[model samples]
Target: MKLYKTYEDLPKIKLPKGQEVSISDSTLRDGAQMPGIVLKVDHKVKIYEYLHNIGIEKLETFVYNDRDRNAISMMLDRGYEFPEVTGWARAATSDIDLVLDIGAIEETGILMSVSDVHIFDKMGLPSREAAEEKYLDALQYAVDHGLRTRAHIEDMTRADNTNFVYPMIKKILEIDPKCTIRLCDTIGFGIPFVDVEEPFGIPEMVRHVKEELKAVNIETHCHDDFGLAVANSIAGYWHGANWSNVTFLGIGERAGNAELEKLLLFLERRIEGFDKYDLKSLFEFAKFMEREIGIRIPRNKSIVGNNVFAHESGIHTAGVIKNPFTYEPYPPEVVGGKRAFLIGDSSGIEVLRFKVEDTLHDLLDVKISVEKNDPRLRAIQADIQNLYNNEKRVSCISDEEIQAYVEKYFLFEPIVEKSMGRKTL
Candidate 1:
């Protein structure tokens, strides 16, 4: 059966220039927040080191407000190395000071809500003007304290008033020349094919925002509510985003964030001069997380999942064996995966013979006593082969086909006479 669409024919995307592959692993902060998944200080440091060894740029290890002082202190004391550890925080004077006090201040990025709804309803501020004033105060404070800052616009996708949001962004850029504002779809509400007129849809607003804030950089942090986190993040890059926040395996709150592996895989194919990282270690990292950390790698999950290169049907297996490009966007080996031919009911005689005579020759060589003329022995072998095939769901071949091969090759008589006087057929 045909999938909804082929990966190649889906759409042709154009990635921007100078879009380097940088990763921000949130395993300690966001990934640990998964229900029933928690880590002690040592466990946190271990994962942090693992991520750093594998070449992740930023590691969102913990929050650094007054609320998480002890955890922050312990991590610092443990001499954790690898990733440039950063803390997530609200754009508040006290919160920012708390982060700086705890030594989480180097190159820190603070999230501030630029959406009018947050300003009016959440902050209970009289107007957008007051919120803008507070943001400027926070930005100035961050810059003065020698903290290279990045602003996060919370709930950016659903902001009712881009008229106000865009201006607020411009003001933040003006206050600090080198500041980078992160466009956050906090509620996982952005889409890929958004209309230019849609309210708070990132695709429509990204170009305008980047153009206005040309002096300052732009980043994107999207959610996967509509299964468009990757698309929206790429859209942001397409529209000139300078940075993007990604987590390993897309693990985060709610539907999770854009997966780092998926994002890198996209860039590798779409953007030239972007494949410099050690991608093989990424698959090892994914497996380590799945086997040790207990996070199940979903079958259809992108990049590092188990089924990314598994083929069962005769047609798909044959096509893949002939030319991987017929079924895969890139060779599985590109990301530390290999093609796997799963023997199941749909396997043709050729497929079965390949598995039985070639792959499973050792298992088949186990001697079994049977009369030379006994169709029963051949039937049993065919039945057992069909059982494994059926259980694995052979989608390419029929039972009759496998049975024909078995009857012809497996039912042949022995060359010498046996003690029972049965001659070779």
Candidate 2:
């Protein structure tokens, strides 16, 4: 009866008592930063509504310009209690002031570049000490203004944990005991393996932050440079971090951040307390991102992709026709997706029969039994095979083509009479 099994000797990821998991979205800020992607105020509002409706806990956005400010204000006007709107700013007094001017956001992410590469090369800072002082000054200003801060330690996976990372965090704790710490995997260099050491081991880093440094709140903001953003974020949570930062469709700078839908689906299945989220809205949200937002979602993308629930192979279609769970990890309706049985070169007779029955029910509101050995079924299968074998057909047969075949093979007096507005058997 077991659907899955794992080794009992492996290190288990049990959440500490009184600790709960939450997802924070950065779609509008980081996701919008993808090259050639521009989200106007209206688009921002619509995306905000989608995230809110899905029960996202927090949403971080930029407030440097009037457009960003107006979007934040419009979203705040709705008065949603779950997704507490937050702001992202560099570790500077001016950036902090911009967030403070927004007035209502109680928390903001203060970016602190920790790695020598960032401090020395990217920022051209004279020394690590100077960088630390600058960040602490900005953090102190935010705390003095009565605003809670999330100290986003940029390039954390590549930073010097002993000299820079730990000492800087200790200093931040001295300023505000309750300040949230966000570990940024800016280059997706973090590894999820438990056996790995610091700098790259995500689990080791999170454990050190939670257990050793005794940080109250920790968030994992990861990128997808190595295609391991979601894995690393989950590792952070499993090792003790509470918040998982994500962007819908994983759209962000370069390869993007952790995908919101993928992470949510994983949490929904593996963890408790996530059932309250409207998981069904994820499909619509993906479509909205693709259509209105002009993002092209790959057909094979996980969770919300069009092909996730589609079956065309003979064996797959037959198994699914008998029992959907045979081929699907979960029901499509769980995420507002539909199971589609596609007819193509790989399709079997069972799929053809099911499509005909389904089409009949749709057209005439009647249920007809279609047996496997029916001559009509064999004839239709022959024609389909001939097209693919002889005519070099490359695409799946559409529903319209299937319906035409059904009409040609089966006597449809009932369909004709029903279309004529008369009751028929």
* Candidate that would win on TM-score: 2
What TM-score would each prediction reach against the true structure?
0.77, 0.93
Q: What is the per-residue lDDT of model 1 for residues 1-425, given as tens digits with 9 covering 90 to 100?
A: 54534445444455654454355666776667766555666556556556655566676655653334555565566564546777666668887776677665376677677677788888898987888788778888888888877787788777754577777777778777787677888777787565756455676667777675573577778878778888888888876676778777887788888877887777776565565455666677788777767778887776787778977666877677666777887777778887666556554433444443432234366544444344544454466566675575435344454445444555553334357675799
* Residue ranges of candidate 1 with Cα displaced over 4 Å: 1-21, 65-82, 358-381, 384-425
The C-alpha RMSD in Å for every predicted model, in order, reads 6.7, 5.3
Task: Report the CA-based lDDT of candidate 2 relative to the real structure.
Answer: 0.88
Q: Write the per-residue lDDT of candidate 2 for residues 318-419, one digit (tens) a residue.
A: 988887767887789878999898999989888888998888787778998888887777888999999999967989999999988888877552223336
